[model samples]
Target: MTEDLMLLQEKVTLLRSEGKYKETIEACQHLLEWGMAANDHKSVLVAHLHKIASYYCIGDIEEAFNNIGTYIELCSIYGDELDKLNLNNILFLLYEFNKDFNKAKATLEVSIALGKKLNKYIIISNGYSNYSHIYCAEENYEDALKMAKEGLDTAKLLEPASPILELRVKLNMAKAYIGLENFEASKSLIDEMINDPILDSFIREKSNCYDLQGNWYSKQTLYREAFESYTVAKNLVESYNDVYLLKAIQAERCKLCDLMNDVQLGYLVQKEYIAILNQISNRELELVALRLNIKHSITDIEKKANTDYLTGLFNRKYIEYTANQWLEQASITNDNIVCIAFDIDNFKSINDTYGHLFGDEVIQHVSKSFSKKFGEHDLVGRYGGDEFIIILKNISLSDGKIKAEQIEESFKSIEMMKNGLSISITASIGVSDNSGGSVVTFTDLFQKADVELYKAKLLGKNQISCGS
Candidate 1:
């Protein structure tokens, strides 16, 4: 079995080295399955790390997080410096791709410290390059330029004429110069990189530099030169389909065409702008109407989709969706996630005691109190009739229970109305924690909260019960 595993690893390495990423990933998965079955922790760790690299190569940031997290944990536990460094690199890329600049900078700091301590010049150079990118994203152009220059200097000291590192640093410096309105400096940097005889293989980097150059040209009202730069940028951006660069280049092209009195081209640009505008409008409509209804907000369409017409809280579906999102974010961030399920005690009896119209007023009053006490972050949805669900974030178990009690107390203070009548109400509450790895799915959290809610009902109404 050991010999067979070794052979499999070798083949996997060969495939990966040959750039057969798909086949390499397949073999890695098979290895992972076998490792899990055998309960071999080392193999499991290696398989996970390799999978993270494959995922990074393919630009799947979210999927990489879970595996990368596991790998980071295992490497820290086992004191593997090399694994730690590799995970840091993958994490840097993942966070950058996800637009989490703060986390990316934090990860790069740790990676750079380790690389410097270990005298890993290549890793150190990569760390500087990535850190410069974070500074660039944060719009700290001075810091970005300094870091990029440091990276280039380090790479040059470690190895002579490193073309890739030089290209990256030059492009970064161009971006910094552009941000500083040092257009001449920016153009100089771009021209040097473009004239570099060895940059032939860095097509993407060169294209991006051209896009930045075009942006500077457009800003300076150099239309013909800007047109050439934007044309190349448009071609490159189209090939990549990068939304950020595409939008920027298209906007520049539109302005230049307008400036040049190209009416036909301007109309074409206007058509494309209209298309993008319509796309955004539809997306906003979907988000505001459907998603808000399914989540927490009141919209015209969702008002129809998720309201009882008589009561203004929520329909049944909204409660389930909001509860699930709360649970998921809590699980990922390791923060306290809690849910409160409650109902107006003796609601049917209240209708019987007074009238159905009075009962409707009691429901509305309770929901209004719920919305008032809970912040926008908390989810409050009516779960049919007198029942309601509230999902809270970033609160501890004790704090969550306190919140439930407060909601109950606040409800008692509200004066409900029928037509010209006043009435009072009481509610039974349940609370549950969604805070640990042992919790399998979001449903478990909901079920646990529901169980406590049942306990509250059983123990007698107008009280609260908490899940253990």
Candidate 2:
């Protein structure tokens, strides 16, 4: 029965990963039934937790809250201190998401008490970090910074440093530093985060690091550097599918654009930012409707409406939104911003010869490969059919050329298999940066890059061209 339950759990995980949220909930229900029948309290708790996660993923927050209640009740009857502590943390997040800051703070207090009772340094450290986040959210920068320092101090007592917990603490501390207008300290923290190997796989944390750096630059009146930082943060959030962070970053970009006197771009980004907020609001409404057992009509639009369907990259509208923000930032700071435009060489012939499906495979393969060659902060988007554009922030013209060459080389090594036949793909890249005296708006920079791209194609497909 244990082995069967384990298999069922795996199935639930797989379903969730595949975005089959309804199926995942159904599987969890099946597991719950089995666990209850067998008198296995732990299994029952696990099943309920899984169901809660699935409901949350599906944006059915009311269902998640109900399951969380059930989980908490079960914990009361059969859980240890650690279990209760963990459940309280989850409750804290749910309340935070719902904007119930008072309740969230109360729950965090309970978690801290539980951790103290358990005498677990890690839990205590996590509690401090979460407390710092709350304070930071409330704009109490000094208190937040102090809490983060306490969290770090607690974490230092662990035999081996808890990288995940430490990272969280550092992130909160960085944000606090930004809030206090300590730009240099905030930048140092972000630089440390970027160089930390443990944070490499934690895309959100790394993204936050860049976001904080952007905020620092913004505070210092270095609008161009701030724009570059924000662009990188936005790209990372998009890549990670973090809608909440994306909305926040977009909002910041809108403000920055307005400050730069680019009212048109500001309005466009503001529109997108409001749309994301509405989506979040609708999710909250769904949660309320669920609690009342009332049916709510949810729009069936794709979650990433701004992204290209095939490559999962930003579509033209979002690219315009980000590019406009970057260009405005560059104009003010006189900082360097580069645009790289590229397309698959002979893409039409490949589509004609190998069929559209294989051509799509090539596009996906190249998109993945090209995206990997750049940092998480750099913006990469599918401009149109075969064309892709990248915004390289804070990079010199010489470096942009070197990076373009590297991308071209990377594309040359891509092999896509169809019908057991191996197909090699290549791309022509054009590089242009704001370092060129005449480049002004994003459109101008992109046009310059496009000209270089045309040169690359004319000089023989698979090569790179750079604009002076």
Candidate 3:
């Protein structure tokens, strides 16, 4: 039965990869039924994950959001570490699509932190690539460049890198360069992607590349070249049948037509846009039916999911949301937003030596101290296990570092006793802030804090590391 389920799930994945979202949704119905009958939590989670993505791909963002709440609850209750990580990753895309850039950045930050803990390099690379895409959408091209370069650098570290995903990252880089008005750099990258054989195999992505090529040409007022590029893109989408991409290409073409006052081009875009929108409307009706058929019979899973019930602190999701708000406010006010990460040193050893109950006690003990010392801050939360994160608003880096040191010193008294043996708990601390004056999101700041946390672990533990 397990083997059958795995094979069926693989089929669904392949179909989705091939852009057969309708088929993917159809397959998910069977998969979800089988998963529920077998009481397989993970399989049910994946079925919903794919179903939601299929809905989004087919231009039903509202349904995606509707289903996502249940999905997140399932993840919170039954998800493994990796399952929860993937949840954050998808939330990043959903938030991005909704134009909630602050929330998007926060989710990506959580995703990156989880990926690093699990050594999921692909997830980390994807997170950075997504950051670049978000910045590109915001027209903050320099930060987009920074993020894309980081993504590429991380991708290079993979033993056998994902070629197609790498190209997509490069595609984002090209768009960023164009937005920055670096025509020469943009053209060089675009030409490289256009010539890459791997891109030819993915018609939908190739169409996108051409659409971007059209934009590039239009940006420079090269109307003939732009028109030719848009023509190729339109034809490819005709074959690929991605209504969303088709509509977007038409929208771009419409702007180009208006720019040049080309009546023929304007008519062409109007015709294509209406045609694609109609196709989308028809497909959405069908998928909406499938959603009604296959949605899991679950309800009220979203109750207080933002709280870590074990310690009565805000959970990762809420922490990210709150910090993102502060980060946004700081961006406008030119104030600093700082974050600190704390990991209980030798926590596993304590779990092994003293009982699981003692370990729980230690966590509660430390969490209490956090509340007393730093509760009146921007955000405070538990990032699972024996780790906690605190966000300080409108604070300088130096001041934040001092607070971290003070917290570290305070932890000396936070410990539990077992049978006359008294052991004190010490933690490795990492502090990061927006003092660099370049970061536009919480993810940027969190990444630096995470790195500094690693540094503290490397520096013999029980020390404080602050990013410059």
Candidate 4:
């Protein structure tokens, strides 16, 4: 089985290397299924990572974003600290590519925080470089230069050193300098980049240097030189068949065309540019439809996971999770937090007197009636077969009692003919509040409400009992 998984992974790698992105995605799906069946979480995580890469390579950033959630979940469980740092780095770059600069910065912060914790100076340095890149994207040149300076200093702390990484940082710093109109400083860096043997080894980097040269020339009113520089960059990008770089180079040409006011030149290049841009737009639109479908599927899965099968209300586990969050947040505000518990009166008798199916109808009917009386902010959950719990925030205890009483009354008034079976129901209610820390946690508050519910049952079946 392990051998089979390894061979499958190799196939995925080969397919991706061949630019068979769609096949690669399909193979990754099988890999996930196989790994999950064997409980091999590491392989599962690897599959998710590869799938994300495939999606990103195909320019499906939305799918990449969706898959990141599950990857983070698996990574947290099975991946190491270095794995986490890499995840942060990948997430930062992913967000950056998606043009979500704020989220990119946020992910970089996570990378930096983890790097600091692990004393991994390389991660910190790369993190600073990413910050510079993000700032440059936002046209915040001063901050970009600051981050680039920091990246440079941090790179020095690396024991062995990464010349390539340092080179990339310098490129970013140079771009920042260009943005700030420091043409001389930019020219110095650009000249160094053009002369560097390392850039010779990297076609994309070399192309980018030429692109920057065009920018420098254009900004200095050197249109003829800028046009030549852009041509060189475009030819290099075309040689590499880099869609992203080609698009950027073409955009620069578009601006140049307008500035030069050369109608013939503009028409000659812009047809291809428009075609590529339209391809991207069409691809994005198709993905938008796919994204909506995926989103619906995800929502259905979440609903099944979190809601009770019988009544379509949140189950015990989800309620516990959500209630705990509310309890944690309650300290931020002194607003009254109420926990209401209730059980259908004589539920066992109802099930025995009628059929269990009819009893189900009763439960569903009561749930609908009970939930509809409360606002969306109220948390409603089926705590047990016949019991329900709700949490309401920013409401007075007296208001909570009134709401509970209303729900009890609502159950008394509703009749349901589910599957041609008729039933009427009422519930005994209990109410408790953390107005002054009478209960400190969700469990404590729910138990207090349960006690009040017991009192309501002792006094009479269909009634509300408030904590006294």
Candidate 5:
């Protein structure tokens, strides 16, 4: 059974290496079931840990947390001090990911205490390293520097010093110094790591060094030097096809562009950032669905998160968030902003005449049509049971009214079939614009459009009304 488990573990590794994250998780699940049935506590723990890694690789934070919960439970029941220490470290990372800084700090303290009690230098060093990173993230450069130095000192006292561990501490120290505006010290540390022959084999570390150098240069207003360093880091990560590193580099580049006041370049970089984020999000959703044995795909989860489940259009929460952001931007740029609110002409009657499911089909069809009619930058969301909202940027009132008319026409042309009967769909739309306003809020715009929509309904449905 142990040999079988080892073989299964190998298969999981191979699948993960091949980017088959779903298959890797499925194999881990099978191994876990076998371990439980065979009463193989060690194998069960290992399987759970493996599943956690696979879930993290696929960026499924929630699923990773679930597996970590099980792993921690098993560790308490059947693990050694070392296992407990490692589990605490994992818990620290999970809490950190959720931005629960207090919990992460507590977990790190537990790891440090256990490592000291067990006389484990590696664990002690790693705990300090992680603690330093947390401080750096929170902008506590002095504390970060102290923790990093402590970690390095502890690492140096190991019977056989670990160069990789030492290098990691050095990197943390460099970052802390960078945060402190001590460019010379930061440069010295980064240069030391780059000059070390032992570190040459670690491409990711090399890339990180360049990225830090880029950050330091950017902070000093050396835009050209920063760009060069960022390019080097990007090229190194690109050679390894490290998507996460690539994403980080792109984000840095975006910030640099913004700092340089290159709005066009910043916009391009922002688009790339969104694209990468979406990819990561989709991959995470896929791993989560697989772990839960759900039949839906990543796209399905994404759709359900941001869109109305029944109509397959953006949900109210998403639209509100995005629309607020656009409104803020419009205020800064003096851009025209328009809001449209619309609902089915006789939605309640349709639901009463046909079944609710048939009514749902009508909503779905109309939502799809609205999605097709809008620009990529436009925002459309299901505001309520039978109502939808759209926010258009940099469009005039006349153009918005034209769009509203087009929407009404397109939706009215749709045919809904139920019980061998055909029904024509029509909608009433209310449009509002913030073209000449000093300041406009989402609530104000929504209310204005909604009032106009009421007027349209009162004047007879399947018509458009405009408001200033």
Candidate 6:
């Protein structure tokens, strides 16, 4: 029975590798039944876990949970701390996707405790690393940093020469330092890692390290270097269809485009973006898998022509193009149009004090907050670093200010960076409505809003000063 189960497991693994989730799940079920009949708990548990993993792979949270619940029950029955760690980690992932930070934290704690009890150093280190990730999600950089270091130290003790461990620890630490505004330190660590001969031979580590390095450069406003790093990371990730790294690298590329002030070019890069997004999305179909790894070879030449990379917001060039078209229609219909300009207060200080990593978190948080606060018809874009512009269709100046205020308040609720340290953000806003006159050009409106934004900044950094 064990041998049969092993053979079944191998075949299922091949199917899954080929992206045949449906067939793999069916095979897994058969193996599971056989293992259960033979009272082979280990094989049974493995089958259950693999199926759960597959469910998660396709973004099926509910089904993933169903399988996980059974896996946990079986693990408890057999007293397998290792399996418990795996289950806990999966739960953490689910909670993370659900945005249930508190639950994720609890799950990670349980996983770590189990690891310690079982004397599994690797699991314990991994648990700590996972725990730190939760803090990262909440923008708690201080605690995240401490935990990352602790995990690295533990991992070091277990596998001193392990490039994988070294790179991961350094990467997380670099992120923490970035949030803390220690750019030099962050750069130094990244340089050392990249220069190391060991990283060259290890694909995953080399790829991830370069990604981190690219992010750091982007935060420092080093556009060309940032682009290079992102390019390298993307190349490495695409070679293996590594979904996690694929998204991460794509994000870095987005940031690079923002720093370069080249939104059109960035969009071109995003055309490949849609392709990759579709590939990951299709993981649900359970169709033939053609190696679902990220296409690392996607070059800047293949992205969309209308999207920005940083903050995942549309770029100014795209916004201008869109706004102009809308303006033409509104003028013909005698409809109202409004434009808003906003800036993060002391953005440079945020970068200087907390580091660019934290600075990035602030930008992303603000961008997402704005999206949630505004109407669907409203157009928003990252005008540049520390700046954003919005276009409102058929909205009043008062309403625009209200919307701006709501977005600013939402930003206040988010920590600028997640790890351990806590940081807050503030912005100044300027709004203009088309009600002022129908003869005004889009550029005129932009200038007026820019003036208002500057006045808001002059009044004081944290307050939103709005005007016509």
By TM-score, who's the top model here? 4
For all candidates, the clash counts are 0, 1, 0, 0, 0, 39
lDDT per model vs. reference: 0.74, 0.81, 0.83, 0.83, 0.83, 0.75
lDDT of 2 by residue, 1-468 (tens): 988887887887788788776667767777776776577887787777767776776666776797797798899999877677768877887888887878988988888788778778888888889888989889999999998999899888888767877888899999998899887788888888878997678888888888888888888888778877998898888886677888889878988997788888778778878887888788778656653432221111222545889998877766776777887877788778889999998999989988998888888888888888887688888998889999988889889998888888787678787678877788889998876434567788888899999999999888899987
TM-score of each model, in listed order: 0.53, 0.55, 0.55, 0.63, 0.56, 0.55
RMSD of each: 14.4, 28.2, 18.8, 7.8, 17.9, 28.4
Give the Å shift of residue 169 in candidate 1. 1.1
Candidate 5, superposed: residue stretches over 4 Å from native: 2-20, 255-468
Expressed as tens digits, the lDDT of each residue in 90-114 for candidate 3 is: 7877888889999998998898788
- Residue 445, model 5: Cα distance from true site in angstroms: 65
Candidate 4's C-alpha runs over 4 A off are: 1-121, 124-163, 173-203, 213-229, 235-247, 254-264, 280-302, 325-333, 349-355, 394-399, 414-426, 435-437, 459-464
Please list the residue runs of candidate 1 whose C-alpha ends up more than 4 Å from where it truly belongs after superposition: 6-26, 36-42, 53-60, 236-248, 259-261, 267-468
Cα misplacement distance, residue 269 of candidate 3 (Å) = 4.4
Tens digits of per-residue lDDT for model 4, 1-468: 888888888888888889777667777877876887687876687678777877777667878878889899888889988767767776876888868899989988888888889888888888999899899989999999999998888888888977677777888899999999999999999998888898777888888889989989999988878988988998888877776677888888888888998889989779878876886677778766755654565466567767999998889877887777777777665557898999998999888977798788888888888788877777898998899999888888899989887887787668766457765677889999986544557888898899999999999778889996
Model 4: how far residue 200 lies from native, Å: 7.9
**In candidate 2, residue 238 scores what lDDT?**
83
| Model 6 agreement with the true structure over 241-332: per-residue lDDT tens digits | 78666876787677667768898978987876777777767753532232132111112211333456877677876688678777777778
Alpha carbon lDDT at 281, candidate 1: 62
